[model samples]
Target: MVSPHSASDNDNENGPGVSLVEIEPGVAVVMGDRPLEALGLPAEFDCEVSPFQLMPPGDIQNLADKISLATGGLNLAAQGVHGVVSARGLVRLAPETMKAMKSGLQPLTSGGKNLGVLVGKGGKIAHQIRWVPATGAAATNVLAALGSAAVTLALQSQLASVSKKLDKNLKETQSIAHTIYGDRWYDLMGLYKNAMRAFREAQDLGVVNQHTFSLVAADLSNLEGKRGSFRDNLRRHVAALNTDQKQQLDYIRENSNQILADVQAVLVAEETWRCFHLLRTAHISCDTTMDPALKEKQLAHMVEQVKREYAQSMDEVSRITLELERMCSLIAILPGKRSISFFGSNNTRNDGEVARMAATLAKTVSEMRNRVHAIPEKPEPKVKALRRNVPDDVLVLLQYLLPEDEPLLALAEATCYGEVFSGSDVYLGITLTQFFVADKDKMSQEGIIDKMYPLADVRYVRFQEQGSPMLEMFTKTDNLSLLFNWWAASGPKLADVRRIRDLFATVMNIPEEEYRDDSLFAEAHQAFAAAKTGMKELPRKSRHSAG
Candidate 1:
């Protein structure tokens, strides 16, 4: 063991006011009771020291022997120091090495002093070990370092826990997807998992700094984007399933909720860590600067940056939280439909009371569609498009059909010919807020009949029979039925019809299976069966009947 008191005696041999003691063969532990700078070393923590073992522990008196014996000894001790510091506590060392170190540490404790250790090749004993009895800035730096390390480790542990949760959630999602979609969604799920894989790889690199943190954040952002698309596809696919198939995949909604929760946890951890990282960098920069004026300026700039980042990060967090909440709300209400009218409501109308539609002039419908196409794409575009596209005659007629104050989202025109309407052509003009019709024979303003039912008000839609296919929508106000055959129309394609159907279903939250082509026949058959069951009598033969 060594101390400042023994330095004078060993000065001539070691160096002026320097003392070193060899506690093991070829290895020395330098102990001091004075500040490192007072014991002849730089008064800073950031400097590097040259290796000392290759040189003599003393200036002369068997210096050659000392140098030969201590060769590579400093390197081993340096490695041990690094391991202990990184571990943040005592670490198990080789039995022989521990015994030697314990012996070297023995005499230093009687004074009740704090000890600090530094290690590097080629430095004076004081350069390798510091006695930090001085208080103030040095002590604060040490404490700050310790605090930052602890917080970093805590964030890492939380992140690991969140990652494990994410893994479990991902597995659950995969199982549900396989059950519902039969492995067709595996490629889609893989896209998100691959993004997660990149995040994990970036994290595994020792020591997360600002750069690595940014990379991981970007990976998570990418995963979020992919997840959004995946969710849309999942919703559409589920909506297209039949009742029995939908029942089989009921667990999907719950699994999706779990996945979203896991993702939220990940993002919170990442953003919190990034905040801490930036603050730590700022502190380090402040501490290393020499000029007081410059340091203050640097600090003020850092504070502004930190405040800006915090605000931005909080905004991001709020956005994500709101998104997750909205998604959860949507999933919670899935597999449910709007109420159907045939169930007999107080507001139900008799067949005679149901209003019939009138046909619009062909020239009017054509002009309206052209106007719709020419509307600009922004600033209440949909509303503007509808208003600008409505022909003067149609608009004047709508005032009598709907409330003048009601808002319209869009306008569309379709030509339909059906045998049920006596093989007459029907012109259907649809708006998000209402549908107006004009029949082929009466193409005048007096012939047009408006069914001003809002899409939002529609609770259910029934598609009945292929011979004269028609859509009957039951809304809060009234039921409106349309006989449509776009195949006979020159303008709208099947895609356009589908677009309108999808828009209606989305607004009504009606499942795709409820309105699909193949399923419509079954739906119509069920409706007929229900009606037949409720019917009081069969039709009787008239005198004009051939039978």
Candidate 2:
């Protein structure tokens, strides 16, 4: 704080660590040797190596970004240079940078060029004495005057040459990109012409994914933003507009894609959608256990499910599968769907509405069928492509249930047991149109059990085909006294075989054996539930028996 001549004190008094050596007369290396000469730059100038703690952090960061970018570009040249060194090495030897020059020039010697400097000059000189030869005299000249105006001029000259070369080669680039991009960007582009071309080529070569696509997109965006600002500035200087000049201003932009098409908009509004949907219409088609072979285990399971519903028609199996698929699909669509169906339909039944309802149900049915058939185990080579478009949860569940071509048994034991769909007029007796009979409505699909039937004597069954049992039996078309005694004889309990078994027994004064088949579905699921181990044992013990 007190002494001017002392180095430490002088720095703090002025700017910390600032010195005459670092504090030059506002020096910068411009892009001309003549400009450098006018400035009378030393053979080497002192660059302040700011300590991270001392420097204004913002300034340091900006400088770091430029240095990093320049270093990367320089490193590209050194890759070909025989004695190429790292940025740290070049910076290390920065003081005696001339001595360190040959190493950094190695890549150029390998038939490359750099108008940029040997980075990390001091560190490079100290550690590795890379004795690389030059690619050409021009490369040597640029390195010799790096960070000075002469070096800048060399870069500028290189840039100008590059610009000219680019102008000359633009047609070739466009040709290559066109070949690569093909039809994806046929009517769209900018640098996307090049970028999308590259992306599609990568895809063709089996590399199209989010990461690579994003990086290329980011590069093109940055390049375009800069180019756009520069183009705007140039347009400001034009006093008179010629067609060619105006064309130059509009060159790339005239073909650029200004916006993405709204997918729904395109689908509903345009010809492209008809083409896409038409194309879609045409195509209609893991794990673990080292103890058993994967393929054999899977085949065995498929054979087993096939055997269970034996003698049933394929159409019946299809109906069960179709129902489960439809149900799952309805649940899937319900998550994001709300509709006008809820508004007017306090069970609405107008003909126009009914037709629309049929159409919706048809679509729902089709999607369900498609999904069931689209099982993961069963997908053929081409089915992979079509099924690739299914909803995620459906795909995940299918993968779990139908692994390795195993056939699935879509059993809906209790997914909807206690559930009820409201409204009485829903499908009380099916539908009758003037010319033909239309039948079954949405409530019927939702399990609105609507029937009953009488049996021998006073005892009878509450048949599903009957409209309502409770409303009927109370009017006592009596001799009902015998059935009340029958119910008391074999009392109902939760342990009963089937609800149907218990109900028939109650209404008919008949034993379970006489009333229903013991191997009915109700009995089978109860067996499976009780016997936690071994599916093989239960079916035998609970076999359909007559006693």
Candidate 3:
């Protein structure tokens, strides 16, 4: 157990018999003080500090939460008061003294004025002091007096409970890792150490407040969550191996390395997620009423952190994508009957484990793909506010293009301007009755020109591949067959084109089977196959044509 007394815990006569001795970095015992006046209590109202460990666990967390909330309103450091007060003792003070203390801590109450002692307290003091207890009508005031240390103590207690579960998880996880990786276990061990270093460092700092403690707790929890996955993956791999195949050191090493790399990638993803979570929490905790400059700085920090985490997450997604592609290429070469096999069919086949790993990889990739798609399209200087793939400017225009009674279903914009189509911008809008493509540019002073095509008239949607694929909507109208190109000019990215196409299809209620791979292309493919068998020369279209 950590000692409850600090090196400076010397008793002096002038002050109360006690000095603060830290039992935890953020928690301390008040050995003695001169009199109530030195610690901000009335001169006649003498009180002694008692350890809060005697309190129930639920009460500790509740008290810590209250203290954390109260610190936002009061600053204990400015008052030159740094010792703890027991919740039990606060009620014991002389009624007059208790009244004075409550009045002093009144800022902790909603609409209460700032206490003379709390005016100078800010983030600095919020992190420094330890002892405080809140109860009764003055509970908020008392909690404020406890300082952030009370929250830290509560957090540490929570960590102790979580740690017990982690210990068991890690022991089992380590044994499985050792069994599979053999001498290579050292690599995973290093990752485990890296994961744990944060918690150890926080404990050593001896002054972790709730936010700081929360960050370390996230790390521990992430590690614990990963333990089961790692164990299951490695165990599945080993269980699928026969006695003879297990001896194939080269294959074993390769597979082991791949698993380790995957785990490391996942850890990076978890860390990124943790950062995003922290940023969100920071945003919530930020004092809107605080100094304008400080709030600006806080907001800027959060924005920068969000950008960094996004970039890191994208990098991980790319790495995972490459791995998936490679797996696909390997699967493609297998015999039809053995296509379900993973790693390979013959000697290398570990169907049970490798197939399961493939499924896991597929799930991970699907989730990452969804996240990537959910990201808002980046805006160009010329265009603005492309939120959720729909530009604000386009949505505004949608109102003018569609009938007043028509309800908008979905909207998306593509940067298909000026190449194939004479426009500075393009937008696709969908409604229950129909979908339309609107083209607008600076030269056209008149409003946007749009062609509305009924949903029932739509025959097919397909990509016309040139330098960049252009989405074409084929429609039949009263003996006329027409193709309307949803111009994906040279400017629109492949991703942008796909997003527009998918959104359009979804709003039009077109089945994925029809739009993704339309039957029209299939008919053409069959016709070409028959023509080839008859030795007829089918002219290959030019590479640069838009239509």
Candidate 4:
């Protein structure tokens, strides 16, 4: 147990009666101030009164030591009584004055107001001296606001950085789409669409700030517009290709039919000759009175006749087979079908259909080859001069327009630009080599032509019934339609239209007879006209309707 303070503790003269001593690391006791009861301590009782350990004693002592040293031995001491410590500098006291010390007196300079300790005499603390200047509350508030602004700025910068990254990704996706071919372009388009959707979602969710969202949204809109344009262009190209394929398919089918017909004709001729020879042989063999050598000679003559007929048939078959081979080769090399799907919707034929068609063509070619092999071989005929049966004026125009190497097979003249039905008159110079559109006055005067389209680029030609009969030539390379109108007072004479159409069909390897006989071509034109009428009528209805 600790001993109690002695009565002589109050007899200090050189120093204050009270002195603070550290009881632990942070706790301190006022050793000689008073008994436990005097400092309002319970009698259950502590031997001495202690201050609360709010701060470490070493920290307070260090502050005190620094002040004493700075003030040149103006000795400062901490006083602790009943869990409270005085912040004032030490006070000098006589024996009687020590009893008047009051722990409740507020220090003249508290730590909140000043840096230095306050010096006191008796129960009162004097004014503080030798301390740092105090900062105003407004200055502190401004510093806090500045710190918050800095943090907000950092968050915004991060958001902007994220938005920039998204923009870069979108651009990269678009660039990739431009570089990719085939179906991969569609894949990249899908990715770009998804990315735009994600960006919009993020903006809606407040993951991106308004400024960043606006900038990115604008970029997305522009990119999406470009993407839409690209898709539209691609769809148009695919549709054009589909039309070309259809034309090629029709040409192949027509050629196949012709070849098959020729083959059947040759077979029929062979069978006819075989029956004739057999009957003649039977007739000769049945004559019992004829000499054996004479009968044999007659039979040999009959056999030679049959051989000649068979040889002719074989020659025709061989020519048809060669033509079939050429057609099949062209079919085999035609462009493969390309398919593009947007968001799981496909509007074009896949490659498999093209492959199947090619396979069927190949099988037909093989069948023709087998039939040709079954026929006896014949020596090829000598080359014959190709007769130029074309019109003299048309021939002259073709000769003038075409290159030297290209042979002019057929030509026709027709009025062009019949759609306008008025004003400037133009004539089209149609040949196997190229189609020339020239103004009649210009050709007769200055010799100026509007345009020349090569027949090689022409995919299909159809007769369109406009105000006048128009020959619509669909070209592959430029994806354009060329219309040639025939000049006739009575709404374009069918004879003139048929003449030009026949020439075009002959040049394009399409059978003219099919176009002449089939009503489907006329029906298709009517359907197209009806669709156009319907489209125009819809808008008119909407404009005038009460609803």
Compared with the true structure, all predictions reach lDDT values of: 0.36, 0.26, 0.39, 0.37
What tens digits encode model 3's per-residue C-alpha lDDT throughout 1-547? 0111121212211212222222222233332223333343222222322234323445444553454345432233222234442222121122343344445533222122221211112312111222233333334554344443333343333233323433443453344345444655564454445534544543444332355445444454554455445444544544433233123222332463345344433433343344333323333333345675565455456545544654565454444433333333233322242323222233344333443443344344433322211112222222221334544454443433344356766554544432234433555555677765555452122233345667766665656545545565555542211122334434444455565556545543444555565699899999989988666433334333535
Which 10-residue span in candidate 3 carries the lowest summed lDDT? 1-10
**Candidates ranked by lDDT:** 3, 4, 1, 2
What does candidate 1's lDDT look like per residue over 246-285, in tens digits?
A: 2322322324333333333333333333434443432333
Would you list the clashing residue pairs of candidate 4? 51-83, 52-83, 89-118
TM-score-based ranking: 3, 1, 4, 2
Better-scoring candidate (TM-score), 2 or 3: 3
Query: Residue by residue across 351-423, what tens digits does model 4's lDDT show?
Result: 3443343333333332322221221122111211112233333333333233333443333444444333233
Question: After superposition on all CA atoms, how large is the RMSD of candidate 2?
Answer: 32.4
Better of 1 and 3 by TM-score: 3
TM-score against native, each model? 0.20, 0.15, 0.25, 0.19
lDDT per residue as tens, model 2, 439-520: 1232223211222123222244332212211111211133211111111123231112124223334444443444665568
Candidate 2: residue 137 Cα off by (Å): 73
